[model samples]
Target: MDFTPAIKLLNSCNTVLILSHHNPDADAYGSSLGLALALRGVGKEVVVANQSGKVGRFSFIPGFAEVVDKIAVNNPELIVFCDCGELRRVGERFEQEIKTIKCSTINIDHHATNDLFGSVNLVDEHASSTCEIVYNLLRDAKIDIGKEVATALFSGISGDTGSFQYSSTTEAAFRVATELVAFGADAYFVACNLWASRSLAALKLEADVISNLKSHCGGRLVEGLITEEMYNKHGVDSSEADFIVGRLRDIKGVEVAVLFRKEDDIWRVNLRSKSTALDVSAVAAKFGGGGHKAAAAFRSKMELESFHDQVIRELMDLFEG
Candidate 1:
């Protein structure tokens, strides 16, 4: 796709506020920080901010120390949103605040559902990850991507593509990975930190999720529940249980996996589909959430039993239709 417009916008801006989705994963951080570092290298002042703040597991990536939880809109010439399908994905507070900001905005994402809510939208739904789009943008801008920048971008691609194990992993994804590696991206470092660095508490939490797993529709749909008590018992947060949904989807004959994680008075529902034909994002969108075709999530305030039945009915309809 043509990135000249985005490149020009970045070149013209002096100060930029970079944001990613709340509860950011590697791809979100990767795209945000990677672009921040690259823009800074070109003498642009950049602030990387996320409502969820810096994730401890991703601290190994360069520039993690610089991430701020609160956005200081402070007259930034430009705002760049990374890996967020919609503006609200940044957080309720940010969404309201950003909509009032008069500055130019850039929306860079890989989700098909992106609303193109930017003065410059650099969205490519076919891209493996937002990091992939950012990588291309940097290359098109003729910006030299150093080791740190490459590693950050590589982490995003690896993450969103499930370390090149997901259906989104394309030849272009592998080609980008190869190029990033050549640019000094440390593949082993990203792998070790993102995949192999889970703590013991996280393992216990995963086991609990498995033990609580419920199969419906004759094993075609699997659901797991993680209560606040379970998180307290394992001393791990919701992020630690992020992998459970994928594991649930991996179960043989399971077409859909749902993870309902209790967060205070509400439950965060994470959905995953094993096949493209079963677009889980459609389900998430019904609950005011949006994401990629295979993975999506939303929050629910309904009683657990009621919500469970509702979701089962929804998925069963999808299955039957």
Candidate 2:
């Protein structure tokens, strides 16, 4: 996708409000905060907001503390959405709030299922992550990327690509990382904080998930469940268990891994696949959710048994066909 339109739109705007998906991951916060910092450096008034508010684990990244739950800017000239596949991914509350704002919007994302909802869409499905696209945008616009901006952008790129271990890590991703490092993005600092800083409670939660793992389809499919009771037992929230699905996917002979996290009356299902043939995003879309081919998710209100059976059937169909 062309960046000219988005570059022009951003240049003309004075105040910008940036948002990302709800229950955000590293890519979401990294892309949003990186662009917000860069825009502020250029004298544009910027406010970084998310429906879920600030994530505690990401506080190491600069400007993480400044992210707000409320829209701080009044009648902003522009709104940029980063790392979101669709508008509703910002959550029901913010989705409704955004509709009241009448301004030209820019959508910057790397999700294959992006809806091109922005007035100026900069969706590049081939890019490794949204942070990679944002880096190019800043470079093309001749905006100076200082150390803080580099760290923010690098964190997102590192996160979405799974620290360059995932298949999405392209040659361009490496080149961008090299440049960001030269700009003083502390690679070691990011790695230590993201990977090595898991709390004891999180580790306990992981152990519990592993012990109760359910195998299906001859071990090609594995699923883990986390309930409110488990959270209370471990003293950790769903964010702490983000690593559980990845661990499940790492098991030998497993093609797909599923994680069911209970939140109130709904269960948020996260899906991860090791084989490209699986296309988990298609499965997610059946339940009104969308993401990349390898990683996708949706929420369900069905009873635990019914939801588990439905998901198993879907995976079985994909595997057998």
Candidate 3:
């Protein structure tokens, strides 16, 4: 849908408040802050907030340090949501507060599952990243691209497109990226900081995960497991294992890569597919999670061995189908 009307609505509204999902990722935080920066550029009063202040490693973008902890919904005229598709991701604590707001609400996202919950929605599943959409929206509104806005938008583009390595990377994504770079985004420095920086504990976890990698289905599938012991031994949190699954997916002939980690009382499964025809979201949805075709995740209370068997069976069916 065209965002011209949404742009007009934003211009008319005052006291704009922007929010993203809980445990905000690069796309979530980047897009929200990028939009907020653009809104502020046009003499608008904007406040950006999230459910949690625990920033991820990717929060090094220019405007990222600006995300506030508390929500200041003092007679706000507009509440905008970015990169959050489902209400569950917003958490129940903030749900009541957000719904209680007496203002026009807008939901701008790129997820397929979005229900258009807001009075105005700019959901486009074909868009490579929410940042791409935000860039176009700001451009449509004739808003100047400042350095802070450019940096935040570039972070979301690079992150959601897997540094322009995923299949979803489109020509428009590159175009927006180039424009953002021209607007003073430090692409090289941001890339280095995001892809290069790693803690000693994270390095150890990666090493252990690599050592434990297993090949299956005649080298067509690769799987790795990171147990609670691994975390304890490395003195690291579960998020330190984030990069392991992507590394597994980079294997030469592997069509599918799976990473399993213990989360609380269940196993959290992250699946990635190198081939285009494989929709990993199907597998994730079967359990209780959902995502895109190439990347998806799910969680189950089943033991590791049982979960492995169930996943293997589902993937085998996918391959055979």
* Count of residue pairs whose backbone atoms collide, per candidate: 0, 0, 0
Ranking by TM-score: 2, 1, 3
TM-score of model number 3: 0.91
Relative to the true structure, candidate 2 reaches a TM of 0.98
List, residue by residue over 65-89, the lDDT tens digit for candidate 3.
7787678668788988898776555
List model 2 lDDT by residue over 1-321, tens digit each: 568898999889899999999888888998899999999999999999999998788888888999999878889999999999999989889999889999999999999999999999889988999999999999999999999999999999998888999878999999999999999999999999887899999999988998999998899999999998999998997787888898999999999999999977789899999976888899989988888889899998887887678887897777876
Tens digits of per-residue lDDT for model 1, 231-254: 999899777788889988988899
Q: RMSD, each candidate, Å?
A: 1.1, 1.0, 2.1
Better of 1 and 3 by lDDT: 1
Give all TM-scores, in the order shown.
Answer: 0.97, 0.98, 0.91
Which lDDT values do the candidates have, in the order given? Answer: 0.90, 0.90, 0.82
Name model 1 segments beyond 4 Å from true. none
* Residue 22 shift from truth in candidate 3, angstroms: 2.3
Which candidate number would show the highest TM-score if scored against the true structure?
Answer: 2
